[model samples]
Each structure stands twice: as C-alpha cells, then as structure tokens.
Target: MRTAAPYASDPSRVRGRLFAEDESAFRSPFQRDRDRIIHASAFRRLKHKTQVFVEHEGDSFRTRLTHTIEVAQVARTIAGVLGLNGELTEAVALAHDLGHTPFGHTGEDALEALMQPYGGFDHNAQALKIVTSLERHYAEWDGLNLTWECLEGIAKHNGPVTGALPFALAEYSARHDLELHTHASAEAQVAALSDDIAYNNHDLHDGLRAGLFSDDDICVLPIVGAAYEQVDRLYPGLEAKRRRHEALRRVFGVMVEDVIDTSRGLLEGLGSVEEVRGLGAPCVQFSPALWGDLKVIRKFLFTQMYRAPSVVEMRKQVTAVVEGLFPLYMERPDLLPTEWAKDVDAATTDIARARLVADYIAGMTDRFALAQAEVLL
Candidate 1:
C-alpha cells in the first residue's frame, strides 16, 4: 500500500475501538477492521441477499456480496489515486451493505412501512446495529467491536444525519456518539461514491442480461450511450455479450476517472483529515457534468428496470413475504430460533418486542424468508 495523503484517515491517529485492545504487531487497524468485516456473519449473509435481484432469481445477477466487492474495487482504486487509506476505504465498501434485508430495497421498503409506528427501517442504521450490537461471534464483545473510525465511516457513509434518525441509528449513536452530523472521512466518502458507480454500471449489465431493457434502449441514454458509441468505434464486429461487457466496462472506467479528477481538483487546498470532514461536503465525487448525466441514467433505470412490471411483480411477492413474517413472528415469538427467542422473551415492551421481530426478519436470507412465510403464514 502507498503512503496516504495528508487529508487521508490515519490508523495511527485512530479514535480507538469501543472496547480497547492491544494494537496488532503486523497489520494496521483498518486492515484488521477489514478482516473482521470479511469474517462477519452479516457479511457472509450478503451472498444470499439481494442487490437488484433476489438471490434465487438468477445465477448471474449481482448479489450484495458481489456488489460490495465491486464497490471495494472502485473505492480502493479511487482511494489509491487520491492517496487516501485504501484499506479503510475497502473496509467501508465491503461492510456498506451488511444490513440490507432479504429482497433488496423492496424488502426494506415493506419492512419500513410495517415498522412505521416503531421508528421505521433504515439499512444504514441497521448496519450500525449489526456492527455495534448484533454480531455476537466475539468472545469479549457482542458485535465486531470495530475501531471508532470504521464505525464512524459506516455511520456517516451517506453523509451527515441532520434530521431525526431511525431508531437503530439513534440508539447506537446515543451509546457511541458517532458524530452523525459531520461528514465522514474521505475514505468513507470514497466508499459511498464507489457504491454509486458499482450499482449504476452493474445494474445496467444485470438489466441488459435480464432482458429488462436492450442495447437500443440504453444506447439512447447519456453516459451509457457515449460508452457504446466508443466501443463500436473501437470494436466494430464485436458480438452482443462482448459488446455489452466492453461498453459497460468503459462506462465504469469513465465514472471512476471522473471521480478521481473531480476529487483531485476539490482537494487542492485541504491539508488535513479533519479539514476534509469539517467541509460538510464530500471530497470524493464525480464532476458536475457527469453527475448530471448519471442522474439521467438513474432516472432511465428507475423507469425501465426498477419499476418494470416483472420486477414490480417480484417485489410485490417478496414484499408480501416480509410483511407476513414480521407480524407472525411478533405474534408468536416462540417461533423464533433459540437464540432470538431468548431476546424476545426478555423484551419488556411492545416496541422492544417489535424490534426483536424486525431483527429476526431482517437477518433472514431470501429463501429462508420465503420458507418461513410459507410455514408460518
């Protein structure tokens, strides 16, 4: 790894973990944080979780695990170019989607609606819950007991939390004071934007593969259209699959390069990591032109892919599964697994029991959730 920039997060200057331990002799703190995240149960569950498609929907679609890896790749590249802590960026990227529910955003949306009276669902906040209080593998602690910086990055990855927070986030922030009002470190910001680049580009690929749209459909869009045009100029006789791959790779590259160039221009006078955080805006971002173009592409995707009839049908099915399971589990906490049953039994209030029910449902894999719905509903 190259030396980090002055504005980069320094593991040596860490705010320390919630439960302190002796520093590792070989690995940096951020590297250890990355390793812990990789070994986490929630991280492993991502393999069976959804990005845009459910896990059982197709073999080729990107799961939360694959999407996180893609985001990490983009984040590390941008972080390396900008002289930020690549390991920290990679760690944040890897852990960013850990709290996602079973059926992608659809499951989350359904759960959020059901929990509206109980403070609602937010995956970012759920991620904080997973890292801080849910993962119980550690002998010394319930959660991963990650470094303060890692927690901060994860909490503020989407920028500041100025308004009222979700229940999970508010509870955790009350305990650890993640400084939710300030922007995260540049590394976290890199991880956040890398998520955008990965999902936007990969969704295009997945949508094309799923027959949600076509080359003709995307070729009329902004950034994607330009990428296809470039690929045609370079490889005129390319086959459809290769042509799609080639064009999309160029789209990914353009987005990555835009962030690097734009961020470099933005970081000209920033001298310290604190300065970067205090700016109250991201230091890692695409240029205004590309950002505008990406918004157009995103709008196109929302209309043609996300809201398509086939996808909406699947979403409705999965949403039914989620909504059914939450109330069933809440009504019969004995249906919960042994470990979760203990938590449910200890709950003294309706809201507490509801949260436990949410946690159980939130942690389920897609197949598991569907199976549970069938048996219990």
Candidate 2:
C-alpha cells in the first residue's frame, strides 16, 4: 500500500531570502547545504578529528567522520522506516557535528568557557553561525546560505526548542509551531537519538579496544549486560572479528525496529494531516521502558568508559590545546582566517572581540584547529 504521507519535500527547494539564483540548475536547499558542507574545508577535517578517542590511535576506531556516517545511516534507517524525509535526516546527521571543536566535547567545553561572555560557544549555535555568517567559501558572502529548515535542524539537534532558538526567534513563536516549545520533527528526533545510540554503544566498544575498560566491566552495568547478552544470543562471540560487525549491525536493526513500531503507533493517533505535520508528537523518543534499559547501559558506559581516569588524562591534553589556543588567538586576531578582521573591528567591546575569536575557532576542523594551536604555541 502507498504511504498515507505527503512526499518529503527537500528543504533546499524551499524558497529562501538570499539564495535566489537566476541561472543555476540547483538542487533543493537542504541538498545544497549538504553538498556545500561536504565540499567545505571544515567538513573534510572531520577525518582527523576525534569522536570519542582521538583519531590517530587506531584505524578501526571511529573518527568524527566515521561517527557522522554511522549517525547518518542510523538516522536514515529510522527516517525511511517512519515515512519521514530520509534525505533531510541524512543532511542533518552529516552537518550535526560540523561545529564540534577539535578534540570533540573537550575542545567544545574549553571554547565554550573561553567564549561564554560572547553569546556562548555552543556547537549548535556555531554551526548556525557557520552556515549563516561565519565560514568563507564564496567571495559573495561570509558563509553558506542554508535554508531555514536545515538551520532549524542544526540549532535543535539535541537541545530543547525553548533553549535552542535565538533570542530574536523567541518573538516569532506562533508562526513556527514547530519552532516554538514543541517536539522536533520525527526526522530530527530520529537523528538525535541515533547520535546517542551510535556514540554510547560504539564508545564502549572503542574503550574496550583501547584497554581502558573490558567487556566484563561493561557487562557489569545492570541491563547493559543484558543488552550485550541479547547481542550474544542474536550474534554470539561478538568479540570475534567476523561477528563483531554483525553484532553491531543486529543491535542497530533491533533498536530501529523498536523506534519504528513506536512511531507508527503514535502516528496512527493523529486525527488529521494538519495535526500530523504541524504538531509533531513527542512519541519519537525511545519508549520509556526501553529508555530505562538504555539508561542502565548509558550509566555503565559513563562511569566505566567516559569518566575513566585514562580517558580523563587524554582529555586534559585536548583541553589544554583548546584553552591555550583561545587566548593567543584572541590576543592576536591576525592569526585567524583573514575574514575575521572586519568583524573584530566592528566589535564595540571585548564581548564582540570574543565572539569574533569564537567565529575563528568554531570554523576550524579538528586538524586545522590542532595545527593552528601548534603554530600559536
């Protein structure tokens, strides 16, 4: 049977203010953003960046690039199953971490502290700034002219809509019911959850490979062990090279099936087309019972993997690199990309200066940021 759903319109095809081109045989707006981001210097740098551990440690472990790919795959799987826009979900998944700092969250934290007074250094907001006004690709403008839908996805990737919107957007609340304090589209929600599912499960696997933790340690964490047991039952000897890939794949397949089952039931309850599209139900999350299981899994990973003394030690080095770089760059903006000079001068105060510094740093990819830090040091 055909899906009783509207055809997913590409956000790129959505009319925008500044992207009106006369002679271009262009793609949709979201597609344009995806392609532009793929071509950008920053997106390419994800290859050298850390997802959990730094990239240079091992070839098998996930880098930012690989992690993004996994998230996109997981997200696309969920979106396609749920009749959401798979391409839009993939686009958001690809661009979701575009503004993550060099060493992942550690670098983001350092930059956030350094730029807190300057409207804060959030990865989501920086991503918005990058697509809207920061990154310099074309001589015509400072950044990529992404569509509002893509911008909205980036801004609200993992946060509450109330907190995610810019101060100005706070006023235009009603026109965007989706923009207001409401649930994100099923696509964005799927991407967000996929990010959590991908990182939490994979990070544990990586931690074990690094010898920072062991499977026994992970299995000790309440229901997480059970989940692993399920994996074992589904694909035993997952530690074996051949089974490891299959094991992970089964986990994703299982989780995605859960999401689809839940979402379809929820969608059935919506009475009309307007309600279905305009007011996204909050039923997109993992069901509470399943989430309870996931929580136990997350807690075990957090204590045994993320906060392990060994990981902290490595993160300290990353923190130092970002912290060291922020001050030096702020003190001498000339070190940044040439585009920042005008923004710096237009700044009326130190707050403005700090914001400009953030613009410079946030635009950097993992490798470029590290290289620049080394040059400054």
Candidate 3:
C-alpha cells in the first residue's frame, strides 16, 4: 500500500474498539472492520435491499449491495490517489448504506414517519445500531465491536452531526461519544464523496436501462453531454449498450478525477488526522462546476426517474408495507420472530418497544417484508 497522507486515518493509532480485544496479527483495524462488515448478516441482506428501484423490480437494477460495492470501489480509488488509507475509506464506503431499510428511501420514509413519535428513524443512525448492537453473532459482544474510527466514519461520513441526534445514535453516544459535532477523518470524507459519485453515475445508467429517460434526453445535459459527444467522435457507430457504458464510464472517471485533484489541494499540508477533522469543513469535494452539473443531473433524475410513475407507485406500495408492519409488531409484539421475544419482553416502555420494533423492521429485506406483509398484515 502507498504511504498514507499525514492527514489520513492511521489504523496504527486507532482509537480502538468499544470492547477490549487482542489486536489482529494479519490485518489492520480498518481491514478488520471492513471484513466484519462484509461478513455481517446486514451486509448480506443489502443484496436484497432496494436502491432506487425495488429489488424485485428487475434483475439488473442496482440493489443496495451492488451500489455499496460501487461506492467502495470509487472510495478506494480516491483514497489511494489522495494517499489516504484506502482500507478505511473502503470500509466506510462498504458500511455506509447498511442502515437503509428495504425498498430504498421510500421504506425509510415510511418507517421514519411511523417512528417519528419514537425519536424517529434515520438510516445512518440505524447503521450505527446495526454495527454497535443489532448483529449478535459474537461470542463476547452483541455487535461487531468495531474500532472507534470505523464507528465514527459509519456514524457521520457525510460530515459532522449536530442538532438532535437520532435515538440510536443518541443512546450510543451517551455511553461512548462519537463526537457528533466535528468532522470525520479525510478517509471518511472520501467515502462520502464516493457515494455521491457512484449513485449519480449509476442512477443515470439504471434510469436509462429502465427506460425512464433516453440517451438524447441526457445527451443535452452538461458533463454527460460532453461524454456522449466525445464517444460519438471516437466510436461514431458504437452500439447503444456500449455507447452508454462507455459514456457513463467516462462520466464516472470525471467525477473521480475531480475529487482527487480538488481534495489533494485541500489536504496538501495537513499534518494529522485531527487537523483534517478540526478543519471544520469537508476537504473531499467535487469542483463547483461538477457539483452544479450533478445538481442538474440529480434534478433530471428526480423528475424523470425517482419520481417516475412506476417508481412512485411502487413506493406507495412499499410504504404501506412498512407502515402496516410497524403498528402490527407494536400492537402485537408476539408477531415478531421467536428470537426477538426476549428483547420484546425486556422492553419496559412504549418508546422502548417502538424503537425495538423499528429496529426489527429496518433490518428487513424487500422480499421478506413483502412476504411478511402478505402473511401477517
């Protein structure tokens, strides 16, 4: 591996895990964290979790797991170019979406609405809960017991946290503060930007594949238009599939290169990871020009894809699933799986039970929730 930047998160001086354990003989803490996340049941469930489209909508549509892999790929590339710790960046990227509910953001919105009175639901916070408490496969610990830096990245890779914290995050922070008010490491920052890059690029590809928009429609857009023009000039008669792939691949490259160049300048002289965080702003960013273009792209997607009629209809359907399931479990805690009975019985308050129910629902996959809704609701 390349020498990490001075501002990079150094696993050598990691803040350590919540529970005490011996260090690994073979892997860095960040690598260990990444492996744990990959091996996690939550991570596997991402395969059936929704991205923009429901998981069952199409075989080729990007699911949460595939989207996460793309984000990690972009993150590793950016972190490597910037001399950040690639493993930590990739780890953060891989774990970033672990908290998303089934059926994409729609499911989250539904559950969030139901959970509003119970301190509300946030995928980021739910991800923290998953890593910190939900996955109970360990012999000595309930969750993965990841290192502090890994948990910090998972908690707030987007930037600092302020205002009201999500209930799970607030609860965890009470025991072990995640320093919700400050920025995360430069590597974590890279992971955040990588998510933007992956989704922006892939959503366009997925949208086109789903026939929500056309190549001509996007050919008039900024960066993508230029890419198509470039492709046309070089491979004038390229097949549609190849052309789309080639153009999007270039679009992806542009975003990646922009981040590396922009952040390299921003982080050039930073002497430590603390400096990166205390810098009080994100160092990893797209150029203003690209960011503006992405907004246009995102706007186009919001109208032409995300809010497309078919997607909207599916969203409504999934929303009902989450909505129905939350109350059912709350009103009939006996409906939960046998394993959850112990926790359900232990939940002494309405708020506690509500949050517990949210945890159970949030961990569901698209099909499982649908199946459960069919049988129970």
Candidate 4:
C-alpha cells in the first residue's frame, strides 16, 4: 500500500514536489529515505558489529545487521498499522544503529570515555554524522545531506522526550555547562521506541541462545513471559521455529498495539499531532501512553538483561581493551591506521586526538579490536 503523506517536510524545501527523482512515478518521501539508507555503506558495516556477542560467535545469535533488519520489520508493521509513514520508519530503523561501534555497547563505552573531553561519544549522533558528513563514499559532498526528516529520525531514534541528555556534543563545554538540548523530530521518536521493542523482545531470544539466560528465567518477566505462556498454550507441540516466531509475533503485536493506541491519544490530545503536522513534514513518535510503557520496559531491561552478570563480566574486558588502547595510540600516533595519520597531526588539542583515536577504534569490528589490543598487550 502507498505510504501515508509524509508526516514531515521534504528536506530539499521544494514545496509540492516529491523527494523522489521524478514525481510522475509517485514514489513517497519516506520511500526515498529508505532507499538512500539501504544504498549507503554504513548500513553494511552492521554485519560485523556486535549485537549481543561477536557476530562470528554463532550462527544463531543476532548480529547488529540482523538486529537492525528486525527493528525495521517491527517498525514497518507498527507504522503500517497506525497509518504512519512506513518508509520513513523503515529508513530510521535501518540507519538508527549505523554509528554504533564494532563491539556494540562495549565499543560505545570506550569511545565515550576516550572522546570524553572532545565532546563525548554518542552513537545516534555519530550515525547522523555518518549519513550527513562522515561517510567518504559520497564524493560530491561530505555526507549524504539526507532529508531533515531522515536526520531527525536518526537523531531521535530513541524517540522524543527521552528525558535523557544529548548522547554527545561537539565540545566539552556543552556537556559541562549542562546546556539545554534541542529535541529530535517525531520520526526519530518512533524509531527509538521501535529499537527498544526490538531489543527487549529479541534479546530474550538471543540471551537464551547465548546461554546467558534461560527461557524459563525470561518467562518470569511481567507481560512478556505471560505472552510466551499464552503462545505455548495456544500452539501445543508446534515446531520450534513456528513456536518462536508465533511467540515473537504475538509479543510484537501487543507492543505495537500499545504504542498506536497510546500515541494516538497523545497525538490527538496532547497537541503533538497538530504540532508535528505543523512542522512541514512527516514524522511520528511515542504517544504519552507509550512513553510510560517505555519507562517500564527500560526498568525491566536494566534489571534483567543489561545488568546480567554475564553481560557485566564481558563489559569489564571490553572496557579494559578499549581504555588500554587509547593512551597507547595517542602517545604514538604512528600506531594509528594510515587513514587517520593526517587527522592525527592536524589535531590541535587532546579532544581532537581522542576523536581520532575513537575514529580508529570505532571503525574496527569485534575481532579486529581484540586483535589490535593483543598486539599492544
């Protein structure tokens, strides 16, 4: 089905014209955003990045690429059901994690520390940089100069009003001064919520596979476990894949329904719907109700998955590896990859040096980082 009229404006500022190359074909603005993201180089790098474990650890676990694809799937379904822009949702979902470092959160933490003085490391903002100014593949420009909508989706991929500080900044003073942050557009808000849904639901599945947690342990969670039980009762003796898929679908259906029902009220009542429409483009977000749900889920993930002992243990090693490498690389700039040498010498201060260090580290995959650390060790 054709996507709804874009909830946001075309980035090009051309009124009444589609973002597509030719409007005669009737392509939607969000579709154009999705296509551009798919063709970008950053999207492909996800395959090598960690989701839970290193990608090569096992065939069953989700890699960053798989996780991204799954988020897109869930986001698209939610968008379609809610009369939102599926294309824009898909675009945001696909690109949301592109700036994530190679080893997943571990890499992010390391970069955050290393870049602490420069500005700080924020994966979402970095993803924006990748598409807009960092990716070298676009010879004609510094970056893709994607639509404001796409940029918003990526920036707020965690959804609007996260009540969280900006993940990073361009300079340390911005952070130290506790500066007020600008909000990301609504489209990014949807992507952010979708990301939460994808990880919370799917990580349970991945956690089971990695021996980090058991299905029985997972089943104890509030609604999710109950949802799993309902699926088992409904489909007795079904094939494993069938059962798991059915279970996932059921859970997703619940979450999506909750988001739609919740968001519609906020959009209609809280004035965001009219508010966003007035912005001149297509974007979507968590209704007030969904935002409440987000807090609940965040608590659960923190208590259950994120703080799990296994994950914590692995984090230590990751912190050590990345932290150890930073000073070494900085002291002997010669240790950096050839591409970074120019940036190294040109850097006028420690923050710039840290960013260069992070650039080198962020570009590495899980194994490459380990390998490099070993050489330094």
Candidate 3 is scored at a TM of 0.99
Q: State each model's CA lDDT, in order.
A: 0.90, 0.68, 0.91, 0.67
Highest lDDT: give the candidate number.
3
Q: Model 4, 181-299: lDDT tens per residue? A: 33444455566777878887777677666766555665665556767788889888878767767776676677777776765554443333336634443244444555565566567
lDDT of 1 by residue, 1-377 (tens): 57778999888999998898998999999999999999999998898888888888899999999999999999999999999999899999999998889999999999999999888989998998998899998788889888888898898878999889889999987778888898898999999999999999999999999999999999988888888999999999999999999999999999999999999988878989899989977888889999999999999999999999999999999998988888888888788989899889899998899988888788888888988888888
lDDT of 2 at 243: 49
What ranges in model 4 sit over 4 Å off?
Answer: 1-30, 159-185, 237-245, 269-274, 277-304
In model 2, the runs with Cα more than 4 Å from the true position are 1-4, 7-18, 22-26, 163-180, 220-239, 269-281, 341-346
The positional error of residue 122 in candidate 3, measured at the CA in angstroms, is 0.3
lDDT for each residue of candidate 3 in 1-377, tens digit (9 for 90 to 100) = 48877898888999878999998999989999999999999999999998999888899999999999999998998888888898888888999999999899999999899988888999999999999999999999999999899899999966898998888899999989888899998888888899999999999999999999999999988899999999999999999999999999999999999998898889989999999889988888888888999999999999999899999999899998998888888878788888786787788998998989988998999999999999998
- Which 10-residue window in model 3 sums to the lowest lDDT? 336-345
* Model 2 agreement with the true structure over 266-335: per-residue lDDT tens digits: 7765543335436644546676777776787777777777788877997898788878877887777777
